[model samples]
Target: MIAGDPAATGRPGLLGSVWPFWVLFSAIYLMLRWPFVATGRFIDPDDELRLVQMRDLLAGQSWFDLHQYRIDPPGGVVMHWSRLVDAPLAAVQLLLRPLLGPALAEQIATVIVPLGTFAVILFLLSRLAARLVDRDLAGYCAVIAGVSFPLASQVLPTRIDHHGWQIAAALAALLGLVDRAPRRGGALAGLSIAVGMAISLELLPIAALFGAVLLLQALRGAEGRERIGAFLLAVWAGSVTAFALTRGTDLTNYCDAVSPVYLAAMTIVCAAGSSTAVFPRLTMPAYLLILAASGGLALAAIAAINPQCLAGPFSSLDPLLGTLWYDRVAEGRPLFTMNGVLVTQWLVPPLMGLGAALVLWRRASGADRALWLDYALVLAGTVLLGVVVTRSMALAAAFAAVPVAWLVRDAAQNLPKRRGIGQWAMSLAVPVLAIMPALPAQFALTGVEALSAAPAKATAGAQPRAGNAPLQAQDLAAIGNLPRATIFATFDIGPTLLRTTHHSVVATGHHRGAVPMRDVMVAFIADPAAARHIVVRHKARYVILAPDLPEISNYREFAPRGLAVRLADGEIPDWLVPVPSATTARVKTFAVRY
Candidate 1:
């Protein structure tokens, strides 16, 4: 029922409805092309690590101790993440590699992740919109809003990561809730929650928040008893099923292993009594609050008891007791680190406020209001908790469009009741207005304009082969040749480097244990001896340093005093006492050395 036949509905022809999808798709496609088009970009955060992990998987690596050929001060092999994120992409690439070869396999896999992810998100969002709004309009809006949103521009066309998959699962969870059949909804919700938890534990709080809202909403309806019972049963079944699927082969054995938090959630749901007793009080705000609190407590308790459950078995250290916890707390001390409050948190709630007002102003029934509020709260909570920076915030920000659309619908309804032209213009305007704020940041990050201007920079640094190799041009070309080379690169270039090439990088994006490696990277930047030692130890063939990368601005500042100083002097530092030049093999952009 969720994915109906597009043609059979007597809706407009594919050509008629296709433009919205096309517009959104083209925008996303262009956004994806921007970094590749510009200075030959790379993702500095987690992309490199993921690529190495995939590489290892393709090379027949084990699932348990996912390893990377790290090139940081720590150098050589190190354990990074579990198989959950990398394995899926690796498997797809592996399948394609035999037929299409490794390069093509990688290309295919990266493309599929985003395309597949968008398809799944679109399908689920479409289902939810259909149930809440009209079926036809819902389908149109899901495609329209989903494609045009800046969030799509941000996530897709980068390397494949768990975050995009998480968004898809989140959409699925919402779809499950909105589905007409409670049983099916429950199962889907359970699965969605489990899969989403596996991808990013940051979403756990949001999941909990959502589950609580549903329970409270169920309690208030006329058939509240049955609704509440169904929802509780679904939550219990879903969690237990998830635990069973992940923990081991045996399903029955998971009972004894069920964490105390799970037990508490079950206990709370049971205490809520049958739908008969709970349903009559559904309209009271106090009842809703209590239900939501209880459900949230259940999730938090589980999280507290077994922190690993949220983000899967392989995870960064627990944020509370782990070293990273203290580091993050110290780093984010300006805000309440203990509470996990992030500063850029204000953006989401205000958007949600606008969405909420629009929802109310639309004169949507109580059920619609409740549903919107529930989704809004969970998403807002996730942002306030500082789970991630832009992507998650964008996910939450995207909901603002839904409410805005309804407001547009009301406006269109009131206008001279125009036929074709006015309605189309109004619909186009709503999404554009909703997504305007993210435009500048999106363009800047993607470097659409900067790409056009790169010719001048290339010309400025023409052929200054001071230190055996031209620093600027080769650095530009090195990223494109990365997949075939083992390179020592700054962390800022790590992600995009991984996405573009096959090279193994040292350290990327801060994880709990990466501080030591980062310190070593710092030493490499500050002291040439340390830098040489890092390069020599890793057997790295190439060294990549990007001055424009903002995250490694500290490293960037040291570039002039460190690497650039050596480049200017034409003297290899004593640490690299016997530095070798590219003697035998030289490519147009980069020199190949062993």
Candidate 2:
């Protein structure tokens, strides 16, 4: 019998109920995160920006208007982010606004949205782990998913962004793969894939992977045919629905987002795939021919819509911005390019899960073997994709939970049953294991440092520098009451100021604002005289920088006479007047003397 089967024996036990599991999981999550929850600090700029988007939506920004009006002025950035993520955050804030006031309402929204996402994940993973593992171990799967460091990091109370939602969508897709009803399973997986890709194009590869898997199954028989056709239809319908709802009427077909090109591509591919699935008995040669033709047609359609997007999302980014900003984005970069100390933490847990899945698949028989085979394949894809895109590790971590839970179960069984001081010491390891999906990741860092013969710049669990936190301080709040005008500052500071203060900014780290991003970098590192012209050209009324920001330090080191460096050294330019009242010792603020 499969794990957590309701009808496996005479009756299912206490762990059979999903509600009890969710409650215990939530209790554990809340207790572990109480301190961070109390502080309510967002560790990433995206979280702050997400809150800003929610505020804009609640403040009656047009449903169609995804632009950040405070970013880059008159023609502000038309954010590529979909409105689906912002909707719930806005809804929660609206419901509580009258009762708690706006500030408290937003605070409550931040806490609720992420936790709600966890609940969805809990529901899906419990069922999925039960089907794949032992029926009794399903709750363990949900618990592990909740506590897994890589996965939990995205859903913690203050992490109110689309990332946690994306992980949940990925988990739902995995669950659909193992469902008993083929048509229902395929439809669920397809819709989840569409939702994820709508939220972020980073999910496109996984969508394609699902299509391939379903099509491969199609070669088997009528059931496979039904599955693939249902998946294709669902994806096409769901993608169109999501696009209309999220994109509204703006069909400008931007290459960065899910534009008309992607729609057209998906349509062509789904049509071809569904057509090939019509026949009752398909030969191997016919299946290969159909797959190749369908893929080719889809590629041709994309090229017809916008050939540049064929290169990828960042293809249109300015070369200067690519070097100065986009390439330096730590999370978006490849796993190997990141800090060596972190490579182990990013890779080990997922790899361990994959290993566990392989071992189980080898030992299983018949139907169980087939289930494990599917699980292993999906885990392999997610783990590889996560390595290529570091931010995607959460997807891998989510899928890995089932196998990791099984591993945890096996470990617990081996724990010393007889009680003694030494046995108690051995028992302590289980709780430590529950805390982080991969506890040895810490030791792995020591291994990396020792092997490299040089310590990495930072440790695996290193916290952000306190002095670098310009967003959390009263210094930025001091400028909150100022007139709504552009603040010409480094990309890192732009989101902070936009979220904390009522002001616009020249550029943010988002790649879509490439032109303004280039302008900001050029203005910072150019000679003071040249810099002022660039700032004035953009109609910037103020210049600002955090002296210790990595970007500001880069400017100071690369060009000693640059405006940013000059400002850092307290060598105030003649055309600039300091805004001392709104400035801090770390953050320099100035009024442009145009």
Candidate 3:
């Protein structure tokens, strides 16, 4: 039997113990996340544009011509061959759209894919935590914490981005590494990092932090040499794979920019560090020397790349403080909501560690303490790196969850054993209590929705009756069947467009690339002249406006100069431009020139 395999015990079956975990996880996640996913709740002003890029990729747009709908703002978010998650979503939708049809495929990809991935990762985290705590009770707690943590709730459903896969990848790597199965652990870690890099570069620092912690553990004890060696080798292999996968036409450009010099330096540092595990007597000296030399080199490299790395926190302190305090507010979102409770997530790891510390305080073996400490350090380093740029909080949270699970598992194991009614009640109460913190927020948002009946009615009154169908499956099917078109649409509409239609959008909520598209989107919302110019420049065939939604501001001045089609339940408006199909210039004036 594979070590730590629950099946080895000849237990009833995986499902007997697993079903309750899933039920609890699903209940909490659905309650908090369902509305966002169902309503296609995309609020970040850039959602529709990124969907355009995804749509084009599904339509067989060339990798070289990755930029679709050319009027995209300069340096706009582009999904450059980052096939880690996008490939599967696009391929599944494409295959199913042709067979089962666009509507079904879209629904499946949006609802099923995100939820299914979350389930798998939560299961693994629970199992891994069970191993650390050596009991089933702790496993249950870890699973609950994994699924119910506020940070996990926010990111798992509402933000249907590639970060989900990255989290799963990191969890898998930790499972392998924590178990001390070097080759397997190393391989998983490497592959996870590579996949993370492909999905989003934001994960690199977190991966590095994880690697450093593992390396430190390997340097400290007798078994350190082999473990460290395995980790370093795994990291190198993963990097090579990631580079191979992502570097196509950009190979030369990336090669020129990514120094072989730095690569070699890293390899040397890794080799020396890995070597210390073999020579225990020489471990401390070798480690200190290696640390000093490597630290010096890293400092030099940082100076070379961006002297800002060495700049005492004060140098870039203003941006950090502004970001922590006011920048999110400046963007017209609550500081708590802008990035989905990023600051709050930081507190989770420590809480988890405290729980673990309580359980392990006197009971844990020396080796286990070392393991936990290593992970704690790694988590801390990851947070620091992630905080440097708030966009990385999702990845940071991914790292944080592991320790939290470990600690929660340990705490649960320490709980006094009970029987019968007490046991059953306790079992039910644990998950409920774990998820209670999330209830207030979910209830508040839903409560706000309830209290806003006046605005809802006002919106209903103002909208065209025909657009009120809530973007049905049939409308999506019809749009998907049409020739690929550039569209003007709201952010909420972008993912559905990517999932169902053959059209490219001007934006999506992915803020990374929305920097360029923001100005155009604002113009579309607040200025009619600019909107007209943008429509002409992109050769947009259709402009979709949701009248009942406050997003009506986004399409306000876009006076339709062409065929306007009011589809059924006309709460939405679809305006068609009658200009020649290929016209690339603005219609400065529609009045007759004669």
Q: Pick the candidate with the highest lDDT.
A: 2
Where in model 3 is the C-alpha error above 4 Å? Answer: 1-16, 23-55, 62-66, 69-77, 90-99, 138-160, 181-187, 252-283, 291-353, 379-433, 438-594
Candidate 3 per-residue C-alpha lDDT over 1-594 given as tens digits, one digit per residue, 9 for 90 to 100? 012343322333433455566566656666776665675544332333334455566778765444544334333344433654556566667778977886567545665556666666656566554545433543454464455443464334434566567677766766656655555566566666656655655455666677676667656665655565666666666655655555444442221122233344456555655555566676466667875686577557556655653553224433422332224332223324443233443434434544443445345556566655655565566555545554444444555554455444433554556557767566544334343433545566678778875653565346344332345555565556556666655544555666555566666544423433454354344334445565656455566544443334223323222111121123222223322332212111011111
Q: Candidate 3, 532: how far from true, in Å? A: 7.9
Please report the TM-score between candidate 2 and the true structure: 0.89
Which wins on lDDT, candidate 1 or candidate 2?
2
lDDT of 2 by residue, 123-214 (tens): 67766766666556667777777667678878777788788889888888877776656788888988898899889887888887777667
| Range of the 10 consecutive residues with the lowest summed lDDT in candidate 3 | 585-594
Which runs of model 2 end up more than 4 angstroms from their true locations? 1-40, 416-467, 557-560
Measured against the true structure, the TM-scores of the candidates, in listed sequence, are 0.64, 0.89, 0.64
For every candidate structure, what is the RMSD over all alpha carbons to the true structure, in angstroms? 8.6, 4.5, 8.5
Candidate 3 residue 245 C-alpha distance from true site, Å:
2.2
Residue-by-residue lDDT tens digits, candidate 1, 1-594: 222332332444423443466446746674656654343333424654566667766677655443354444334444423345676687788788789998767766766666666665555555554555544545445543554443464356544666667776776776665554555665576567656665555456556666665665565564433544555555565555554444333222111233344546566654553333445545557565666676677568667666555554325434322332224323223233222122223243335435544455355455555555555565455445433333454455444434444554555555566469867677555544443534544556568556766554567556643332212334445456334556555544554555545555565554533544454355445556555655655566665443333323444444656652443334455433222332112221122243
